[model samples]
Target: MNDYENMSDEQLVQLSLEDQDCFYYLMKRYDIKILRYIKRLTTISQEEAEDIIQEVFIKVYRNLNGFNRKLKFSSWIYRIAHNEIINQYRKTKLRLAMIPSNIEDQANLIDSINDTIEINGAYENLEKDERVRKALAELPDKYREILVLRYLEDKSYDEISDILRKPPGTVATQINRAKTSFKKIAGRHQLNTGIVK
Candidate 1:
């Protein structure tokens, strides 16, 4: 409904706190995006991902009154979701990013990774780019997260810092380190994947 859609996320937050029904609009706008982010960040199955998303939205609603006006709503919600993901990982040692978000350019980069794979033999299936998946999976958690936020979400350094609750300078350092680590992993595997830089 235009009435709901026309309102900014901050305005809707105020409305939702007063009337729970108003929250659905907020859910509708972010559910899928956050869902995809969940999957990309974790190896959770579709069902589990949905459960996490439900938890995320519930947290958002419960914390509605605490939402900060100085920050973007999207950033705030993402920070909550990221914390949830970290908590899930801590509790269950759940999976982290293994697949890129299916960006054509990223897919191309994944394919290039195949050439760099020092594995004994080529993966029979590249459809899911399993080799590429493994490479991403091998990355340290901090590195994997930075790459996903930067590339898949197309987020800026400040945005990523906000989501990760780190200083902007730290985020920048991690991103650089992530790229270097990614390259090192490729080197260890003897894959000649082109420069990720």
Candidate 2:
């Protein structure tokens, strides 16, 4: 497979520390996966997602010296990404608070509609995809992250647990809970559209 896959973590880390190209290679391996995770969490404009992705990578690169070999590299990068997204969300909240109440609501509503439309267009059938995306959007971050990593990203429970720093049993339980929540939201949406269960 990939060079990194064959190399020991210690070797990769050593290479990354010594060479900028090695760091770039590491970023190339993980960037899209991390970006997809961030996008699902933020549900914001693409520009905002790009900005956060840069911030996350920067943090990861700068902090490489401190990385522990005991942890999986993917987990470490995702942890950085998760923190960056939370920071961005807080910043967004403060900015929204500074705006007029009516304007803030309207802006959020428009953004929601745009997100819905974008997600809808990605699927072959608009209504079902919209329902699914809306359901996903409703999930709490903890549940949503696990669900997306498990189902959408096709990661095993062990991988998800590592990424989230949770036990495998906890990841399994959270995924089940998230699926139940998603089904409820989907069922309600389908009923509203006259789609029979």
Candidate 3:
């Protein structure tokens, strides 16, 4: 074990400044978690998600000196990842809108998956997963952001508020509302698919 938890964030910052390898250690610790979080937020292709991950890390490396020790390192990195994904989404949406609809098929899209195994002779969960992802993608960005941050990223309301620069009470209400909205959307999708009676 690297005992990274034992080292203070300030110490890590100092070490990262002096040694590039030390910075790589921080990236190794958080990259996968951040990538997974980003994957749920946007429907970008896997290759594009990989590129965004690299870009987020590069931005983190360049801005490491400005990081404050008061905030947890994970919070700081996730904020960066969130910003990068949103930026990429805007760019992609603009680009796609400019292209002819028929030619948009050239874009490499990654199919999102949602899978869970059950032991009670239940129907395969793949259908449920697909419905959820479709419903989630249809939500407004504000609702989707709160949902992913709360459910998928497993971030506390305070952490999410800090990351999003929102009030804690607002975050809580947004999450509550988002859950209802998501359930409605998922229900509608299930009905449309003949998966629910």
Query: How accurate locally, in lDDT, is each candidate?
Result: 0.77, 0.63, 0.64
The parts of candidate 3 lying over 4 Å away from their true place are: 1-10, 94-134, 186-197
**lDDT of candidate 3 vs native?**
0.64
lDDT value, residue 91 of candidate 1: 87
Cα lDDT tens digits for candidate 2, 113-156: 33333322233454554455565556676775665565455678
Residue pairs whose backbone atoms clash in candidate 3: none
83-114, model 1: which lDDT tens digit per residue? Answer: 99888889888877565544663564454444
| Residue 133 Cα positional deviation in candidate 2, in Å, after optimal superposition | 4.0
| By lDDT: ranked, best first | 1, 3, 2
Clashing pairs in 2: none
- In the range 1-197, model 3's lDDT, one tens digit per residue, is 26755676567778889988787667777878887766666555668779999999999999998887778788888889888877887776612111112112111110111211111223346655445556655667787667557655668988998788789999988876765665567567752322110
| Residue 45 error, candidate 2, Å | 3.1
Mind sharing the TM-score for model 2? 0.67
Worst 10 residues of 3 by lDDT: 104-113
Candidate 1 local distance difference test against the native: 0.77
Specify the highest-TM-score model's number: 1
TM-score of 1: 0.81
Best by lDDT: 1
